[model samples]
Target: MLDLRLAPMAGVSNLPFRLVARECGAGLLTSEEVDARALVQGNAGTRAMLRHLPAERPLAMQLLGSEPEVLAEAARILEAEGADGVDLNMGCPVPKIVAKGHGAALMRDPLGAARALRAMRKAVGVPLTIKIRGGWDERTLNAVAIARLAEDEGVSAITVHPRTRSQQYTGRAPWEVIASVVDAVAIPVIGNGDVGSHADAAAMRTATGCAAVMIGRAALGRPWIFATDAPEREARAAIVRRHCDLIQGHLPERIALVQLKKHLAWYSTGLPGAALARPRLFQARNASEVKAVFWGLW
Candidate 1:
């Protein structure tokens, strides 16, 4: 069994975010879902996403693509670039992505995904894994079948975010499907979605028999979620400051400060007039403005 993992948010899991998640008690972290084609063609933005700090050990670079050749090459590139592992994106169900037959579209084509997994297994020296949903839709639920295929192809692990593609982040993730996946694969299966507290994480393990838990939306502004006893306003200030410093250390001061605006909004929820604070934080263009949004408001 592994530790708590941080999922690769589409636009958020950069070096700074992963560093912040680590400080908040995440065991393993994945970079944002990267486009394999972008890496192969030398996209600077995609390359920049590969940056990491010495303290952040065992970080996996998550890749999103449907082509076996490109995905294999990208996995090779990640191994050469010092990544600890490579995880394929077979679960994303965004319309724009699915239209291209890239994301959860793979759920509809298990044979192709299996073939891609095999190719990537042969291409990379480091550990290879994949993240998948229940299936393209409720009608085609086949997570157990896909899990076996990835395992047969030598994937190190499989992550099951149990919402079907059609559900798309709506409703609760079906932990039962995770149990099915764990039963089907010898490798570790990390559970994902809707875990907001230690109890939720613990329940996920108890209910699904998964080895690890991947925190997504619940981890956004609540990184210290596992550490906080009560997770009230009393804990918000300290977490915000620590995250701000982490961001500052990893990125430009201004970017870090502004980025905290979104997180602050989430942390400040349930407080008196958090609505007022959100607009102010977005309107906050500097550090002093951020301080006011947090300190003055409280």
Candidate 2:
């Protein structure tokens, strides 16, 4: 089956959000990128990111780093921590990561990327996957080449976000490039980029023949996008309340309230009085205030 999976977003895809996405029917869930070096060094904040609920099984822990040794060590750590699988992040385009020869920078060195994959594959018994961009830029588009290298090094699957590092998240993702990578690899090629609705998911599959579709920014406040049934107003309010409760359970009250503000705003998206209500929603300082924002909308 071509299942919909959640894309790993740095600050957004926390345990609370992942739980919501799972309840809404996501097939697979990936943790936000955890720095391999930080994990190996035992950074508490980074280690905290590894905490997952038992329900979020079939989870893939994503690690970001350029060194094969450090990545391999981090994979071992994740395996020890009960991660179901591991994903190497080679697609991040942030300047700091790129400057350090990590993320999209690896596309410039296919051999090094392959070496890292091989080491991680050998170190862990769990399935290993790689997520990558088309290339550093249009002139160096090498996703197909890298997909082949990943398969050769024993990668279990590959995800292609069909935009170059230079393109970042701007412009339309080149679905044709994803199709090219799919044709070039025998392993499952997961297509990511520009998927916002069920129709977009279907169109991406039809156009690229990808094994699955991964939803990123689109899944933001609309976790129900993965569900089979469209939730009505009352149901939507209940879901929002549950989401706020989950956030409270997972984080401190104050921090949770701060986080809830954005989610409150997101849930208001497309609502009749969203524009009029946003100012008060953003001004909310507690869960009660946040709930009142939604309740007011009703």
Candidate with maximal lDDT: 2
Question: What residue pairs are clashing in model 1?
Answer: none
lDDT of each: 0.83, 0.90
Candidate 2 local Cα displacement, residue 59, angstroms: 0.5
- Which pairs in model 2 have colliding backbones? none
**Lowest-sum lDDT 10-residue window in model 1:** 225-234
Instruction: List model 2 lDDT by residue over 1-298, tens digit each.
Output: 4499999999888889898899889987999999999999999989999989999998999999989999999999999998899999999999999999888999889989988999899999999999999999989999999999999999989999989999999999999989999999899999999999888999999999999999998988889888777788677777787888899899767778877988878888888898898989988877888879867876
Q: Which segments of candidate 2 are over 4 A away from where they belong?
A: none
How close is every model to the real structure, measured as TM-score? 0.92, 0.96
Off by over 4 Å in 1: 228-236, 252-258
Per-prediction count of colliding residue pairs?
0, 0
Tell me the lDDT of candidate 2.
Answer: 0.90
**lDDT of model 1, residue 156:** 94
